[model samples]
Target: MARNLSTNTGSQAVGGRRHTVGRLVHYLLASPWRVIVMVLAGMTAVAMIVIGPKVMGEATNVLFEGLLGSMLVKMGAKPGTSKQAVVTYLQSRGQDKFARMIDSMNVQVGVGIDWGRFGTILMFVIGIYLISILVRLVQNFLMTRLVSDAVYTMRRQIEDKLDRLPLQYFDRTPRGEVMSRTTNDIDNISGTLQQILGELLFSVFSIIGAFIMMLTISPLLTLIAFIIIPVMALCAGVILKKTQPQFTRQWIRTGQVNSHVEEMFSGHMVVRAFGHQGKAEEEFEERNQELYQASFKASFFSALVTPMSTFFGNLSFVIVVIIGGVHVLNGSMSLGGLQAFTQYTRQASQPIGQLASMGTMLQSSLASCRRVFDFLDEAEEVPDIEHPDHLGQETGGKVEGHVRFDHVRFSYDPAEPLIKDLSIEAKPGQTIAIVGPTGAGKTTLVNLLMRFYEIQGGRITIDGVDTSRVTRHDLRSHFGMVLQDTWLFDGTVRDNLLYGLDEGQTIPEQTMIDGAKATHVDEFIRKLPQGYDTVLNEDSSELSQGERQLMTICRAFLSDPDILILDEATSSVDTRTELLVQQAMNTLRKGRTSFVIAHRLSTIRDADLILVVNHGSVVEQGTHDQLLERGGAYASLYNSQFTKGEED
Candidate 1:
């Protein structure tokens, strides 16, 4: 048998891949102040790092010049004599700057070398590094805060979006996949923002700063170092392109795996009862293996980037050393300058290597971002009308629960009209029972009534006013629904009962107990160890299905909605329990219009109006006695149930 939930099984694909990345970039830059501060801090830190090696080279030169002068003086020449000799020697070599530097060194005279000056320079270098560390600390802090805030905002937006999205979206999309987007995808983005943002800024600044410093030291060495850049870039690009799709597949497969696991776990009892555990395991293994393969391929390809980049970087270093050595020996460059140039070469290549390694991580993050943004951009529910009509007290009137579906037309698929030219009206406080076979658009009617879906044509009205003219919040506030599947979150019984109450509206404890007592939920609550305070887990498996249904009935009672919809509300309970629930429902339905959808004909036998719906349109409708006397579709259905009961 086919399942509606599995219809959309495939990797989520967004149109225009580059556009998705662009959107992600736009979102990241939405906070200009944070970006600006991060850039400044990173650049300052890289500047300090780039300049440090140069300062060390200067210190080396000072030591070399000082030692040379000290040795000359020790060999019987006076300090001034040595300094003058050094100046003449430098001038002879066509080095005017060195000659002037030697001339300036004469201030040290008999001292020969200034250890204090060298110490000061070393301390200054250390201070620069310390300041860089401080700046980076601030940058990390800022990045953490920024990423956290962005993720929080994204989560909040997603939550709000979920609330506003049409129910059809969820019907088509898997809950586990949605969970993956909300959790795994968003987490991926968060990790990237926290880690990659800092690394990216540093890499860019390091590359630029290193390139400039290398050029200043020796353009020839800079040229040699840059020779490997294009090669490394091409390699990284190829690897990234291959791995990008794999990463996308990986996350998709991960979501699929999650979906399968969640489904299996949630239905574990059914699987076991039917002895389908092996089949479930086999299916899970298949999905898990696919996920494994995708992850392995993505990681394997990405892993190649770092070693390949390192090899090229090391190759550049070797070439630079061989060439720079010749320049130093030929007296075209000083030994200290050559050392500084070598350091700059490493600095230049380091960023390229870092970026190469980060390429895979960045792509993965982008993929997750695209998935998250796709969800955020999903088509929302139709917006409420401008200047919506106020429904209740605000409009100086009460909701009378008079609902009319006028020339109603609808279809899940536009090409196939399920319900067409249908019309129905329910007077205030009347009981309307809709009976139909499965897939006969029974629930779809309730959905339309609650505005969970929009009608393609015609209109639904409440109290003679078009429902579309009222905000969904106002429209839905008038309805209390008890679905076939009872949804009980993890909370105490009292909390679950009070979940329907509006915020800041306190329902007294006695009132809650009264509502529960009316629904017979208090009987089970008193039997529990913790009574009404007993905590329920996610599935609420602690409570029986009948008990859970009673809790839902109590919730509906507490809500005191102007209109009520009970779709198989008592289908799960025993006959006796059903009677008690029906009694409570009757009490709750007093003075409120109610729409009851039931498969068991006995349940709605006393309804004020019985609607026999077939293939989405009413075949027959009348009061129970009138329908029976007419011997129409309703009579056939009611008699079939009566005959089946006698046979049983």
Candidate 2:
């Protein structure tokens, strides 16, 4: 049976709307010099883009004027013809004020056109475009490095933050949710920054630059183009408002899906054994469907912007063409000016559409960012005392392992105190056995001893010094623990055995071998193909349950802690393997003050003291023989186990 673990499901509070935006802005501006460089380069790029169309229009005008002058020369005009002759020639053709007004060039008498000027204008336009491309390349390079560095910093901060978070946080929060925030959320923010930063800059500059250029070309046509701006803004705003919430929901659903998948995969064996595969699949499908709906809604709404903008753009184009044509014929606008205005109209509308699309992405990224920042800002464990007491070096033989609980009080929830006025003592070299039914707060006693959880009232002391006065690291260093659930990372057997040793602390190879031999780990390692050098992958499925238990026992032996905690350490092994492990543990417990929480009555018969815990209180405390003689809870529990064993 699994113990009931406590969980906290309260939502974390994040910054308000203004604060969230401000935080994102702070990350964007983290590297001031890089931002400055990107800005300058981006502005240069936009300037070239804004000016390119007008330059091309100038090229068109030059070609038109040269062609008209050449036509007049062909029609019996004199060489070195002045502007008057051109005006008169156009008037002869019944041309209106618009044509005469647009023709600003002085007439040149030549049989052929001025191909040199046309080439120069075309080259100028090409040069501007090339410069724009180069500047944009620089901007992109700087922005990429900037975003990379910011994300790297954020990831590092998260890594460090995890170290400082209290164990209680992990106790309640699902591991998969934490992982999603650390990985997926950060990835979303990184990608969004990479894309949105450049697009946002270009879009803003394009809209502003295009509008100004359009005004210069012809105010009447600029006004005609302006009519579409408000309409486009309204349409895009409505679409964005609809999509933003969908984007938020999409990312939220993404996290749920990731968490569900992780949970199912981790428990896949159990699911299959219990024939719960259909139930797991159903749960996953539910999450997946929610994600699909959110994604579709976000995508559909965002997709509407491009075509809608295009529609408005085309409408403006038709209107401009009709109005500008009449102005050109009336000599109030040139054909070149009308063409430049048309391009400006498209340029202006393009950014509006881009803004709409980017709005969806930004909302998603902001949602992710909010989650990340909220996690980073969570309250850390209380700070250690300013002047912490130090337990003398265990190797120096100064640790006595005299642990005591003085009227300690605690509860997972404040309204229901689990352990009230609990007090116990273990003298040096005493083996204290804790026996209790499931959920009797047996493990909670070990948690209090190690200070894994704090007591709400009273104190726990080790060797006459209050445990709370010492650093948790120093306090925990005095004890070695082996739990029912074995934890082994992916490493060689040698590495796992040596994991407890502090950095820069070397243990003799002979000592490691002796510890392995004492725990019977050597018996199996020697039978393996690689002896002790064999690698263990995650989950260490390559090893049998007995073999893994032996390895953990070996780890505790290698640490040589002054105090040991074996919490149902041998409960999962077979009967023969348990006997062998029990013999090893008996040897390991000779000189240490040990706390054993066990369900098997046979394991604790020789303990110096047996604590019968019921409902978080020690209902009986005495030697095993004394407790049985009393015919209390301990005796009843012992007799039931004995009777069940005999019956079997």
Q: What TM-score do all the candidates reach, one by one?
A: 0.92, 0.92
Residue 88 in model 1: lDDT: 77
What pairs collide in candidate 2? 98-330, 98-331
lDDT tens string, model 2, 82-108? 767667776878775734663544346
The window of 10 residues in a row where model 2 has the poorest summed lDDT is 4-13
Candidate 1 lDDT trough over 10 residues, lowest sum:
5-14
Residue ranges of candidate 1 with Cα displaced over 4 Å: 1-17, 67-113, 393-397, 644-648
Q: lDDT per residue, candidate 1, 400-455, as tens digits?
A: 88899999999999888899978999999999999977888888899999889899
Provide the lDDT at 232 for model 1.
90
